[model samples]
Target: MSDDPYGVDVVACKSRQQRLLAEMVEHGLEWVVLTRRESVQWLTGAYVGPLFAPAAAMNTEGRVTLVLPSRKTSLTVAADEVLPYEEKWCSTLRDEQRAASNTVMMSALPIKLRHVGGEWSQLGPDLLADCEGNVINIEPTIFRLRRQKDNDELRMLRRANDANRAMYKLAREIVEPGVNELDVYNELHAVAVQKLGEALTYFGQDFRSNARGGLPRDRKIEAGELYILDLGVGFRGYYSDNARTLAVGGEPSAKQVLAWERVSEVFPLVESTVRPGASCKQLFEEVQSLLDKSKPWVFNHHLGHGVGLAPHEGPHLNPSWDDTFAEGEFFTAEPGLYHEELRAGVRLEENYVVTATGCEKLTDYPLGL
Candidate 1:
């Protein structure tokens, strides 16, 4: 075991590498190249932001691509935009052996920086071609391993939940008639930054109480309308996602009140059933059964989804999916009812982690109007 980087466990990272290597050995493959951003971030604790995106003219789809062989040989080819940060991050991880680095290519840009020299193989173009037929897709194996949260990952997830709750609390407080929907949207993120010391990676608001849902506009929020505010925060590379629908003006209509009541009752009931060996399909069906039958309950999306490194992970909460709950897996129980004709919707989403006995709610914000 080596020292951890920020919140990433080096030992756990190496274990993940070995897991992938074992998969490669089983398939008789020598190496696997990873181009997806999530894959690269999982392998290395290094994160490359949008500032590193390829220029529109460059036409390069590459971000931070990695070459991982069955053995110790590995390489990360960074995009030209964020090459400097990539270099420094690589060196930091390499110094502690957190990153496998046999060569450190110097930047040719005008900026002066010390070069950690070594030979680098030109593997990008060749690996991308996969002409040798040795490269295999790493997503299947890596994504399976990512579904469960380790202790270290849970710690970061907790922080993300805290930030998300803060944002939601602020959003609820400012949501009232006469306030512009855009004002609420912008302030949610601003307050999140003030509370979390960083801007959230995902923040969304929709004020279409009269419609199924629409993006926040300059139009002022009116009384007796339903609005949805979904939020997420990235902490130590982990993520937290939660959403809530609040009433805008005076007392909610009987129909609106009923929508919240049904979701409120169903959320806990569905969430409580999550445990190792529980079927995700059964849970989805159960939640659907709890919805009000008299009114139109249109759930545009799945019942819920696993949330972690990415917003949506595996063991998807869908009746069509046969996945069963597993210990250490995190998920969201988001049962929504969208009445398009009523032009209003009510959705209550909360994060949970499957446990040995049951599931634990990670986000504890109260559920109500």
Candidate 2:
């Protein structure tokens, strides 16, 4: 079951589907079939099963079915499957054979071409045998529409941010000298399970001491060493990712502190530059310039990336990326400096949402040693 308190309104889901159907009509398409899980969820708010399995038990032979409009105007499913459509909605459950027949029936209904999304390559043979019409893919159209978030999605993303912060706080509280990397991972996992319950979708912890190498792996923290904590936590399906470098008992070395300060300063510069209509490439170049001055220990990754339904979404802050920042987009601004000679690194990341004027920082943690 989804954590969404509204319980996946079938009416609202149908409204979304109808809008897509209208788009199809405008494009000269008469009927369309959706197959991918994400596309199916966006269109009908219905969850189908066994998409990633073979054709035997899971029925990967294009068993999942959806038709835009029909004379009967009802939802249909296999006997083993459960229909998500509300009873009030024009939905009916039918056997798999009946469902496939409805697809043929809908294709014959005054529609022009048949548009299909997801597993189309697999279902093409079967569909072509039954309906003789032009078949086109709708993956790109659906992707473009779903990439940008809505207000309700932003609310779920905010909750994910809150859960992510709680996990980070737990890491800080339990991280100390003599703590193993897996130990910290377990501690933070416990906090997430206790606070968020089943709402937590994912949790990961990568801990590495500044000694040996900065690469996160199975290692134990020692006094006077640096520990890096990288975590991603989620609520519903939205995700939030954050990373922090911690100092053990004593003060961090001068080199580590300097690296931390440089990355910290760069974060605000990146955040301030993010706004609707700003070029992501230009902003990345500006941030890179600041790192060049503090050269010899340069950061080697993208300045940031979008964070929402997927941990690494879009509008990446990199020199090669040319996408423009848009309002309502949420992303992370993480900058780090690694010095192999010193075997130490410093990185600080924060989440931000692009606004009309500028941007809003989602994470408010302090960024010093």
Candidate 3:
């Protein structure tokens, strides 16, 4: 129904570009470089992968340049200038790849450049030599700018979430005793792809049962175990992360049922407590307190996090970061109790978008185990 599957919007790109320009001025930067996949896509609206997505540099004057191999340029990228270098088929970037990156990014930047950018990204050694100025970490600024979802971005994310919910529904129907973990993974992936009507850019969160979370193993799920399907669907460069757990063989032990019931209680507490100015660390403690902390049957993971171009974004629901909730941010909240007593563990996650009054729940599905 839509001509642009990635939902690239020039107006949104332009608005973001303006923000970057302002950031450049604040940092006294002549140019700012972005090589990370999501960062590039954020500025240029290009659906890029880890290997081939071009590096982007924008000047204080708003001149934007995208550098990559020629073969990857067919898609409409939003840069003002497209700089292509020679390359063979798309394989992993080797020494020659590093050289190619060095050439164009150096040309686009000043002899000695400084500004806000990803310091830990795949900048070539030669390019690093030119980054003589003190590098300013721009992630916080970038996150702030991107806090409010643009209409197009919201559309893409909503589609991914819908696909996630559909896959969960299918998982409930198909996941049972004797079903191989690989089989469930394959079916859920297929369901997501079919629901989106396009190939998934990325898909994962967790897919194994009888454990906290991991890649779907080839082992057969057991009759008395709880299968945790923390599905992550990446569509059009945006991602949706949520989870559902199911009891194998359509039956669960009393301990398993109790654990799930406890996990389910966190949702209402979250709905009542999460708001624009809440402390993420405090919120994490509140959720943590509700869970049973007995030695093995304990909750020992991040409470939740934001989801966007990168599956994990900001507004971290963990004590590690001093993140504060902001209106218009989309994130997840998951509560769980682990260990053998509860048939391995029970984890339930839900997605939400922060609103003025409270937060709008984005995840649509019944929560049960």
Highest lDDT against the true fold, candidate: 3
lDDT of each: 0.61, 0.61, 0.81
Per-residue accuracy of model 1 over 237-335 as CA lDDT, tens digit each: 567778888788757888888777777787668666888999998888877766746356666567888877887887788976788889999888888
Per-candidate TM vs. native?
0.75, 0.74, 0.90
Number of the predicted model whose TM-score against the real structure is largest: 3
Residue pairs clashing in model 1 are: 209-343, 210-343, 211-343
The worst-scoring run of ten residues by lDDT in candidate 2 lies at 51-60
**Candidates by lDDT, descending order:** 3, 1, 2
Give residue 320's lDDT in candidate 1 (0 to 100): 68
Give the alpha carbon lDDT tens digit for every residue of 1-369 in model 3.
Answer: 238655578677878899879877887877777766678888888775655646788887898888776777766767898887655446545547657765877787767666546535565456656566676666667766776676677778888988988898898899888899999999999988999998998878788888889999989998989998899888878988888889998889988888888888899988998898988899999888778444457999999998888877888999899888988788899888898777788999998889997998988798877
Question: RMSD to the native, candidate 3?
Answer: 2.7
Off by over 4 Å in 3: 89-95, 110-118, 128-133, 137-140, 143-148, 293-296
Model 1 worst lDDT window (10 residues) = 53-62
Runs with alpha carbons beyond 4 Å of true place in candidate 2: 1-28, 44-113, 117-134, 211-217
In candidate 2, what are the lDDT values of residues 158-182, reduced to their tens digit?
Answer: 7666666777777667778877776
2 or 3: which has the higher TM-score?
Answer: 3
